[model samples]
Target chain A: MKRIILSGYIFLFISFVISAQGFKVKAGGNQTFYFEDKGGRNQATFFSTTPLEDINGTANGIGGSVTFDVANFAKSLKGTITIQVASMNSGIELRNRHLQSPNWLDAAKYPEISFQIKSVTELKQIADNRLGFKILGDFTLHGVTKEVTADADVTYLDESEQTQKRAPGDLLGVRAKFSINLSEYGVDNAVIGNKVSEKIEVGVNLVGSNKK
Target chain B: MNRNQKKILTAVVIIIAISFIVWIIFGGEIFTKTQVLVEKKDELFPDMITKEWRNKFIWGLDLTGMVSFLSVIIGGFFYFRLRDKKHK
Candidate 1:
């Protein structure tokens, strides 16, 4: 009876060690990291600079999931990042209304702006768990879909006592930046050049966890 | 170009100027904004979250455009009324 109890304890210890191995970029196969941050830490920002006004808009409603394969980080990466159109705030009530109106993004008609990651390129190992790469994705905005390449830096954080304070599982910190032309996206507003820039610079900063 | 008309026009200018000066003194915003985004940093994350706070409206006194328009309309009414009185 004592021998059986000792064997059971050994099995439990091995199970804990196997489960706590954490994420290794070169060791694991595929892990789906979810970007739905309940802490409201995920944010996307847009900046339009013109001679008349410099508009800075921010959106906090960002949610998505990305499946990252360690064996093939380039081809096996797939995910969609979405931003709610109505969640965009430009600090001005009138401008915010105009931005969501039919003349601009038409938040009522197309309520979401999303990016579907198609491929990854220029992958460079910044650290043992950090990578710098360019994510080529289909960017859908204002009911128009276009291919855009975003420069991205991603870091993998293993689940530890310190990291568990922020999330329950392994975390992925992704910072990406990209630019878009309003004309190409069918946004032909007359205020594009005078008040708002034709090309808008966009940025996204978020942390995702591989809990599920 | 009479004395009363000149006085009324001067008053209009003063009203517009005072409105503009007060607006500048308070917020100086070219366009009125309802809310302002204040950034807050996280303990471990490098990115920041923005908190929305209510911005003071100054009871429409902060709007230079609206105040200027109303002043011009009221000032014009008084100026034309005085002009017609002189003609009568």
Candidate 2:
């Protein structure tokens, strides 16, 4: 029995080592949505605290995939994010219904919006313990795909030895900011018949541990 | 099954009816007015209101309205079922 217990401990340790190499993206990350007019003033800001709501509006069972290279932490990030367009919620039931209608997202036809990262610049320390990078990727929305570049900032959260054991790797907080033009993606503003400008601002913050 | 059972069923039916009446009288008006107010607010002072605030109001209405509407429909259905059983 003692020998069996020892082997079990060893097996658990190995599994932990393997898993520790890559950090898992937190679902509760903050994603702020904004829409601006031609004048460049900020118009509307919508927060998607829920990943399910962020992906499409409703909470779908499936989650997005994100992988960061520990060996090349500064160089790149590659992953696939699949969102159910049908789940897009603008708060109002009627507005949600209208958004899903053929005029907007057309959930019945498109159903999903996905993003796949193509490349990223290495992390550079801008301030004390603050790191920043530029991530370039293709964002697919409303059945249209376009290239997008986002600026990301990372901050280290801990320097204590006790905290190190409780949570492995340096505790990292990430914030990414980017913009998209709805017109570029061919999304027509159905709610207001007038053509709403394409520029939409997106900001996301993720907190997790980075290995290596 | 018996007089007691029939009485209980009748009470449930009455409760459901009262709920519907209350919803129509108070909830319905509030729901309608809020909807109109939201539209007007968006149009007249688009700059004054942030998208976050607007979304919050809309989300609250949608969630509350859906719950009330669903409750009424489901409660009515159950109440009618009990009445039918009592008659049989």
Candidate 3:
């Protein structure tokens, strides 16, 4: 009886350690577009908010992976995402139609946007609860891929508090921010003219449930 | 009132209501400020790009546009059905 109890405790401890270290990718994020000239003014702007929907040309879900290396100072992430060109919403039906045409996203030819992270730098911890880091990656859009860097904030929620609220353990909240250029990806079209700004911003918040 | 006349009036009313709603939702003066911002950006930096601001603006507009689109579609369908009944 004594040996059995000891083994059970060891097993429980191993399980807890495994559960504490993991990664998950969140899909309900937004990618926005902005156009401005040299003067720091904003020009035409729009966003693809529902990028995970089938109507938006994606595969009905967002695809990405999260990895946690508790022993190491840094974690890693990489995955491909599909954004339906037709899902681009700009308030006006006419404008949306224009965006889906050959001039913009060209949903038919380039139906998805994919990203692959090449490196990650773990920065100093912020506020004890939040971890700061920078991710260097390559994003592909409209058939053109470019290297970019994004800021990330990762937070770990106390297990006892999370359990009291009945929240999933894996979903310790995560937030990431980054920016991109449309012109660099060759998404320029006639309706937007040359007046469209090349820069765009992207943000992601992921709540992942542990698979184990 | 005759069924046909009743249907026609209903259709007209619905159409007007929908147009009003669209005007209220999409025709607001917010775009004016957006236009101004774009113009300023173009004139000042010309080469610099502010992706963060643009993305946030685009994301909000996208959400609003989607909601409005759904509302319009539902409203338009009712109007069309009422109009078809009147024509018959």
- How close is chain B to the truth by TM-score, in each candidate? 0.63, 0.35, 0.36
Q: Of the candidates shown, which would achieve the greatest TM-score relative to the real structure?
A: 1
Once fitted onto the true fold, the runs of candidate 3 whose alpha carbons sit more than 4 angstroms away are A1-61, A73-86, A127-129, A158-167, B1-88
Q: In model 1, where do residues sit more than 4 Å from their true spots?
A: A1-27, A70-72, A190-195, B1-14, B26-28, B47-62, B76-88
Q: Model 2: per-residue lDDT, tens digit, A67-93?
A: 544433444456654556664444456
Q: What is the Cα-based lDDT of residue A147 in candidate 2?
A: 91
Model 3: per-residue Cα lDDT over B1-88, one tens digit each: 5565466556656665664565456544323112111212212212223232222222233444555566567655665564544445
Cα lDDT of model 1 by residue, A1-212, tens digit: 99999999999987754433223453377888898877666889898986755778888788889997764566678999999999898887788899999889999999999999998887766666777789999999999999999998887877789879988888888889999999899987765534677899999888888995
- Score candidate 3 by lDDT: 0.49
Kindly give the number of clashing pairs for every candidate: 0, 8, 20
Two-way TM-score contest, 1 vs 3, winner: 1
Backbone clash tally (model 3): 20
Candidate 1 Cα deviation (angstroms), residue A85: 1.3
Query: Model 2: runs farther than 4 Å from truth?
Result: A1-62, A126-130, A155-173, A207-212, B1-88
DockQ for candidate 2, C-alpha atoms: 0.03
| lDDT score at residue A60, model 1, on the 0-100 scale | 77
